[model samples]
Target: MKTLGKTILLAALAWAASAHAVFAPGEKVIVLNSGDGSISIVDPVSRKEEKRVPVGKEPHHLMATPDNKELIVANASSNDLVFLDPKTGDILRRVPGISDPYQIAYSPDRKWFVSASNRLDRVDIYHGADFRLAKRLPTGKVPSHIAFSADSKLAFVTLQESNEFITIDLGKQEIVWTMPTGKQPAGIWMTPDDRHLLVGITGESHLEIYDWRARRMVKRILTGLGAHNFVARGDGRHVFLSNRMANTISMVDQQTLEVKETFPVPGGPDCMEITRDGKQLWTTSRWIRMVTVVDLETKKVLHQIPVGKSPHGLYFQSHAPRQ
Candidate 1:
């Protein structure tokens, strides 16, 4: 098998040369949680590790600032958030006090970074620009993941224990609505139009679509096993789901509510991110201790780049034009 970086496929053939929508040239970055108290920075296009920075422990998820200059990582074991410089992989700041910060999301305006702490059963909000503590909002129990509306007016947080999705009004910084969802929904994502929220049924391998305006379940799609992380294509018609237990990725059609295709991945793929150009879909395999890059259009594994053990999460820098 060809190793990552060594094997290069024709970007035109792989992506149909459709203006390369995923990662921009000369300006792409990859963030991976080592799952052993460290985080590594890699250039997605070059497949080279820039630096490895140590954190508290078991970094569960990560989010980059709006400008893509700084990265905030959730250290689940230590119950804190670690901030770092993405280019050099240096620790710049560490925010302590969250309990089991498992997942994170940024507001549409990118002004606030919100985290869901499973152990503390609360949601902690941080000012993105200054990295300051804004407000800690309490939830029902075991908040796993969070998502923000496109308008940045509201945030939907999944409370695993309560089996409900809590809606927080960003302006008031408080919970305004609670909508019940499937059992143990772990990850939450919003559709491109911001008209629906997709809740992953972590316990049973299913996906539930909730209409934002109607505030109810519209459709439920059956995926195979331990569905966790989800990523949507730029067109908003296709959504990719990671089946953690099955070691595979499933492509679902949004309009038809059907799984269009499934492809094998390296160990159990946890979290995934597609390049800004849409040429590739990258996933971190925890057990295999590597990052798997797949040609989304071909549905074939292009290369596997080795990283630290138990890679938990992956984050790609959004494309930004030069200032």
Candidate 2:
């Protein structure tokens, strides 16, 4: 009887562990539909759309607060920010008077908040704690994306129409310098060590590596046509880039700056997010109005779930930490 009871207890423990695995039933993946201004809430385990909630007009990008309490979505056309519960996809409140917040992000230190105005050709800096406008810096034409330095003292912005990269000093609230880049630079990402900047040249088909200290192009990594955006794979060594025109995603080595693997993804793969266990990749299919789930190890698309029109940004609470 004693041995039997011990065996039963061990089996119960195993069952509990399996029940609490990541991507369990209550967890969800959020997708932003830019065309229809709706948010699709998906279940990762069941791989189904749970519900759709209407947000503001033209919600392009989103980011969670530093404290992880609220997820803020930037509505460019409406000129407002909608705060939502990160776990439940419920709207908490809406804050207005933000001018064309196309892409928004918080600094590493959580002291500054910056938004790039794609149509207004300006970048707005706000106090991280109170969300008050600190300064409005006039950038070049069409500021599309933003990336900050490690220390949070400087920020880098990509100008899509002007074909330039500009850096702003956060403390002084002024443009420090600007340098020319490839045609139509859209996404900008800083290396982990803050030594190099990777600009996704949407007009061309390559990524330009620029040295920030020296202010010069170090090298160019030839990716698929329309290299658009990047996201780290949670591992310290690898990063992934979405090549929109080529309809492929490239796995790149961070240290060597070489393309390790390239997987064919369809329907204009724009933005991406990885699962917490790092076994799957979720990307927004802009043209197809769907989201594609790819098996990381096998490099095969597992499923494509139809979403609203023009899906762009994707997020989940249980995501792997960005490298």
Candidate 3:
């Protein structure tokens, strides 16, 4: 009887350890449902959604605070930023008067916060410390994605309608230069070395690589069609770009700047986030209203979990750092 008791206790302890190992404590995947104005909280380990939290209207994009304490959801139609507790998935507060904040992010140095107003054709810069409007610079039609230089002195924005990429001087709070790009450029990512700017041409099947220092286009890396967004693997070796129309994800070597491999991801894969361990990728399927999980080892989609309508931005506290 005592031997059996000991065995049972050991089994129970093992079960507890396995449960904790599945997910890091206080970690949950959060995705923005733009079409339905809701947010989905999901368990990465079990691949199950825990709850659906209603947020402001047209919540399209999200970003973590510089301190990593709060997750800010930008509701473009509602003109507000909803702050949520990253661990608890609870609404902390909402700041209003942010006009058409389609996409928002902080500078690398955390000195400035910028929002791209897609519908209004403007870019608003705010003081990062207090979220005060410092400047509202006019941009081309439909400013979509944004990226900051390594030193935080400059910010690059993609004009979807105008098919151009513009640089803004954060210190001067003015436009520095503008250059033409492929049609409907949606995602902009700066390489880790800060040597080049990669603009995903959503209307085309290639990514434009621009030499920012020389102010010229260097080369174009061809991938699947509707090259929408990018996320670094945080391993300092590779980055993943989602091709929405082609329904695939391409892995590119950061150093060689060459396409290493491509994996099929159905349902119009859009935004992406990588796991902390770099074993898996989480991406939102904007057309199918689901989140697809891709296994890096096999380079295949393992499964998908249903979320709300038109899921766009996705994030988790325990994710790999954006390179």
Query: TM per model?
Result: 0.82, 0.93, 0.93
What RMSD, rounded to one decimal, does every model reach? 4.9, 5.8, 4.4
In terms of lDDT, the best-performing candidate is: 3
RMSD of 1: 4.9
Model 1: how far residue 147 lies from native, Å = 1.1
The residue ranges of model 2 lying beyond 4 angstroms of the native Cα positions read: 1-20
Worst 10 residues of 2 by lDDT: 15-24
Cα lDDT tens digits for candidate 3, 1-323? 99999999887676446435645786788999999999999876567889999999999999989889999999999999999988667899999988889999899999999999999999999999988999999988999999999999999999999999899999999999998999999899899999988899999999999999899999899998999899999987788999999999999887888889988999999989887778778899999999998878888887799999999999987778788
lDDT of 1 at 99: 61
Worst 10 residues of 1 by lDDT: 12-21
Superposed Cα deviation of residue 288, candidate 1 (Å): 2.2
What digit string (tens of lDDT, one per residue) describes model 1 on residues 20-69? Answer: 34545544355555556777777655676666767778887887767677
lDDT, candidate 2, 262-315, per-residue tens = 999999999999877887889999999999988899999978998899999999
Q: State the lDDT at 146 in candidate 2.
A: 91
